[model samples]
Target: MKFQRIGEHGAERPIVVDGEIAYDLAPLTGDIDGDFLASGGIEATALALARKRLSPITIEGLRVGAPIARPQAVWCVGLNYAAHAKESGAPLPDAPVLFFKTPNTVIGPFDDVLIPRGSAKTDWEVELAVVIGRRARYLDSVDEAMDHIAGYTISNDVSERAFQLEQSGGQWSKGKCCETFNPLGPALVPRDELDPGNLRLRSFVNGESRQDSSTADLIFDVAYVVWHLSQYAVLEPGDVVNTGTPEGVALSGRFPYLRAGDVVELEIEGIGSIRQTCRNAG
Candidate 1:
């Protein structure tokens, strides 16, 4: 099953998308958020839909917001893909390289992504985003880590190369936390519905293909990433983890940086896709 939030930003209504029909989730929950997920919302919603307890609603002209509400934290893994690491001139890490993007950077899937003011190196990264359902602390094994995940969605990990590298003072979040830097969703596919290890995730800038790679290339797979993170920080429900991007980003100097009016589209196998227009931040 797939879940979505549709309407204006911050005012979206929760929904369950089954094939072409969208069922209202308002009767069961107010939003697709941490509280809901932590309370078996996905299971309840599925059961309700199967019993025809949910009302089918029209979503013809509604805007699609991020699948989940703003999370308490947005964690990220850097260079988990070996080719991406090589392209960026970084050595493969023996362990996960972690960072955080301020939670407010999360935005609707189809919203406009702002190119930060005085920025000339804004780049795009398409990544598989994991949404945590259960609180995870010091998880014992990779096998156990799967139990804590709720679902997966796509994330456009937009960045300003200058701010991330030249001006970051060694902290990558400086470039990652800009408003609207993270465009997530269209829908979140439940963990059982898709295999995260081999999904195809790609990015296109202005109709041209940029990053095209599968999660199979990940040096550290999904389960290990979750297990590894748990050792250092508690993973709460609704917190998002972006599992790094593949090769072919602007940071490698292979393509031109994003400019205002450029359209960026990202898609992950099984989890649907998102498109965003680029505009200069005021």
Candidate 2:
């Protein structure tokens, strides 16, 4: 089953999707957020649907917001893909390189992505986004990390190379935290329904392929990333962790930087795809 929020930004209502039909989750929960996930919302939703307690609704013309409500924090793993590291002329890291995007940077998968004003190196990265389902602090082992994950979703980690590398005195978040930089979700697939270990994730620009890689190439996989972060900071429920992107980005000099009106599409196998039109920030 897939969980989603449908309607305008800031006013979306939660719903669960099973095949062709969509069911309202309003009777069971107000929204799909940290509180809902931490309290076994997914399990309860399953049970409610099984007993025909949810009302089926049509979503033909409505907007689909981010699958999970705005997360408390959007954690990102940098240089976790060996090929991507090589493409950017960086050495393989001995440990996971971490960074963050402000939670508000997250937007609906199909929404517009604003090109930060005065930007020339806007780029695209298709990543596997993990949604935490429980509070994890100082986790004992990587094996136990899986238990805290609620589900998986797709995140288009839009970036501005110049801001990320040259302008900010070496901090990546400046380039990362622009409004609409993180386009996330058409649906959040439960962890039990999909394996995050080897899914294929890809990105395209203006109908041309830009990124094409698999999670199999991740230098630090999902479990290791979660456990590794837990050793340092507490992982709160509803926090999103972007595992990182693969090679074939504009930063590699393989393609031109994004411009206003360019369309970018990111897709992950099983989780689904998101498309965004780039527009200059007003």
Candidate 3:
């Protein structure tokens, strides 16, 4: 099943997506958050639909927010794609390179992306984001890791090169945490609805294709990433994991950095698409 939250930025209402029709789910659940997913949110939504308990509502002009309510954390894996690593001139890591983007970076799929103050090399990364459905701590195996995922979403891991590489002492989080850096979803699609491992994801800037690749190229697939991270930290429900991106980012020095008014669109097959316009920070 697919789920979405539509309305103004902090005032979104949860709804279930059935093709182009959207059914309001507020009558059954408050919001699709960690507690809801961990305590049978999917099952509850299914039952509500089967019993014909929801009313289809119109979302003609409302904004679509990230599907899950603010996640506890937004974790990211870097250099997981061999070509992407090569493009960035970095060696392939032996394990998933983990990083964190504070939850504040999360923004609606179509929201405007702000180029942070003094930024010169803001870039885009199209990645498959994994939404955890259950707490995962020291997961026993890849199968166990897979079981903990609730669904998938598309994420544009917007970044700044100078802050990430030059001025911040090599800490990627410095560039990753700017407000609106992580534009996350149109919907959270249940794992059963699609296979996250084989989807094709791409990024475009101002209508020009920049990155084009598939999840099949991931060095550490979704299951292994969850299993690997769980050994060191507890991954709670509603946590977001950006699996990694493939090649063709602006950081390769092939394309220019984003500027105010640049439009960036990120799409991942099955999950959905996100289109964000870059603007200067006020």
Candidate 4:
């Protein structure tokens, strides 16, 4: 089942999408959060649907929020895609290069992306975000790592190259944490509904294609990423792991960086799509 949060910002209610119909799950759960997922919210939601306990709600013109309320941490993998790594002038990493985007970067998929003050290198990255369902620590193998994942969602790993490279002394997080940097989700598609390893994910800026790539290009893959991460830090339910972005980003110097009034659209096969408009930050 595909799950989503829809309503005004900060007041979204949970719902499950079955085809074109959206059934409100607010009667069963207030919001889809870390606590909800840890307590088997997926299973409970399925049961609720099967029992015909939810009412179909009209979602016309309503906003979509991040599928889960707020993640514990928005962990990211740098250079996980071969072409993306090459485009960014890095060699294929033998192990995942990890980074963090503060939880505050989480915003609805349709929200406006802010071009931070004095910014000039704002860019976009289309990524498949893995949402962890179960606690993971020291996983023995990649298969074990897959068991901890709840589902997948689309995340535009928006960045600013100058802040990330030129001014940061080489740290990437400085450019990654601006407001609305991570536009996530039209839905959180369960693992059973789609193949995490093979999916077509892409990005379009102002109706012109910028990045068109697939998860199949990922050098680390999803399972290994989670397993490798578990070897050090603990991953909890509702924690989002941005597996990495495929090539076609603005940072390649092939395309101009984003500016105010530009619209960015991100899509991942099976998961869903997100449309964000760029705006200048005051």
Candidate achieving the largest lDDT: 1
The list of candidate 2 runs beyond 4 A from truth reads none
lDDT of 4: 0.91
Candidate 4 per-residue lDDT, tens place, 223-267, comes to 999999999999999999998988889889899999999999999
Give per-residue CA lDDT, model 2, range 139-226, as digits (tens): 9999999999999999999999999999988689889999999999999999999888889988889999888888999999999999
Off by over 4 Å in 1: none
Q: Rate the local accuracy (lDDT) of all candidates.
A: 0.95, 0.94, 0.92, 0.91
TM-score (all chains, Cα) for each model: 0.99, 0.99, 0.98, 0.98
Cα RMSD to native, each candidate?
A: 0.6, 0.7, 0.8, 0.9
State the weakest 10-residue window (summed lDDT) of model 2.
Answer: 166-175
Superpose all Cα atoms of candidate 4 onto the true structure and report the RMSD in Å to 1 decimal.
0.9
Q: How many backbone clashes does candidate 4 have?
A: 0
Q: What is the lDDT of residue 123 in candidate 1?
A: 95
Clashing pairs in 1: none
Error of 1 at 38 (Å): 0.8
Q: What is candidate 3's lDDT per residue for 134-250, written digit by digit as tens?
A: 999998889888889999999999999899999888678998999999999989998888887799999999999998889999999999999999999999999999999999998
User: Model 4, 78: alpha-carbon shift in Å?
Assistant: 0.7
Better of 3 and 4 by lDDT: 3
Candidate 1 versus the native: TM-score?
0.99
